[model samples]
Target: MAKVSFDGTSGFEVPRHVAIIMDGNGRWAAARGLPRGEGHRRGVEALRRTVRAAGEIGIGILTIFAFSSENWSRPQSEIRDLLGLLRLFIRKDLSELNRNNVRVRVIGDRETLSDDVRGLLEEAEELTRNNSGMTLVVAFNYGARQEIARAAQRIAEAVVSRGLSPADISADKLSEFMDAPDLPDPDLIIRTSGEQRLSNFLLWQSAYSELVFMPTFWPDFDRTTLEQAISEYARRERRFGGLAAAGT
Candidate 1:
């Protein structure tokens, strides 16, 4: 509920939590006559930049759509490349992230992942569990619809085991069952590559988030791109289904 201010003459009101759908990797690679894997590699570099920029700009939480459940439907070779990149990123950047006090939180179905992959994710969280700086949420193998269904299943199990009445279920109760209920909902959701839709990222958590679509590809995203999105978010009024303020 607290507001973050940009320390500049722009007087931008930065969002406390920002979620990004990193898209256009393949297109970027294609445009450059390079393999898609190369684009993904560059995308990772952009991620490193964005993370540093977010921390420097006073962002409390940064959630990224790293890999989605539907991404498995892509070519097996591409899937392998993505998983490899994830492994490389964690192995190479985990130490630096911890030293900088960045907390890593992963949300998704871990049961389906290989033991090694799962272990790495667990290690990332454990190593940074006590960090006090910005929290980075990686949505790997995640889908909002599946997350909601999983929460519903847990609620049902609790009702059966604890003899709780079904009437006690509410929106807030359902939210508490989500993967990372302690994390606040996103205040702004940005999709790069000119995408206009969420594409299954943070459906429930983005109910009132300001959406910004950028023509820039994921590999081209930088601090300026992030600032542009934040500036646009500041220019708008979030009514949340109510009337705007009396003054303009």
Candidate 2:
């Protein structure tokens, strides 16, 4: 990934990879006495703005928690609306994303999705596969625990069938089996709607990521909110489980 300081902001190193848990769409809609579907529509706009913002700022990768595996339990109407919005996003925005030189990558359970939805996800990735700009990873129907378990299952299978030793499976090797292994680990993670928990977004990948909780809803998020999150990220010291550097 290219190293570009964020507009020469002194004392701040821009994160190479930033992940966001885009929460509170339903809540935002309810507070306004509107249907949850409207909130989701607006969230798509937010995602568009965020992608452009990340690219303009030279961030290498931006991963978003769009939908979790547990979200399947929501109301059937809401699920339909959510899936509809996803389809609309791909059909409407795929060209723009490609024109902007952004690469789209989907990381989640592809097998569980319906045929049409799966096709759309694959289309988004295939259309923008060779873009040179920032990579946008959407974690739809993704759960960290499930992802880790799947990786472990793969490792076990490899050991048994491929003559690979179990002891050779280090953390780095294990991550190769996880989703989006080619993407770098998140340097900073931001969750909106004042949520402090990860909610099973990126458990294994965000092991040492700096976290920021924002009070803004997903529909209201813009480049300013993203910059604020990055600014907050800039204020921290990442020790990666070690002691702080000298001179504080």
- Compare the candidates by TM-score and give the number of the best one: 1
TM-score on alpha carbons, each prediction: 0.96, 0.95
CA-lDDT, candidates in order: 0.93, 0.90
Which 10 successive residues of model 1 have the least lDDT summed? 1-10
Query: How far out, in Å, is residue 73 in model 1?
Result: 0.7
**lDDT value, candidate 1, whole model:** 0.93
Pairs of colliding residues, candidate 1: none
User: After superposition on all CA atoms, what RMSD does each candidate show versus the true structure?
Assistant: 1.7, 1.9
- Candidate 2 per-residue C-alpha lDDT over 1-248 given as tens digits, one digit per residue, 9 for 90 to 100: 44434456454557999999999898999999999999999999999899898888778899989889999999999999999989998899899989999899999888899999999999999999889988899998899999999999988999989998877989999999998888889999999998799999899998999999999999999988988888888879888878788844
Superposed model 2: Cα runs more than 4 Å off: 1-11
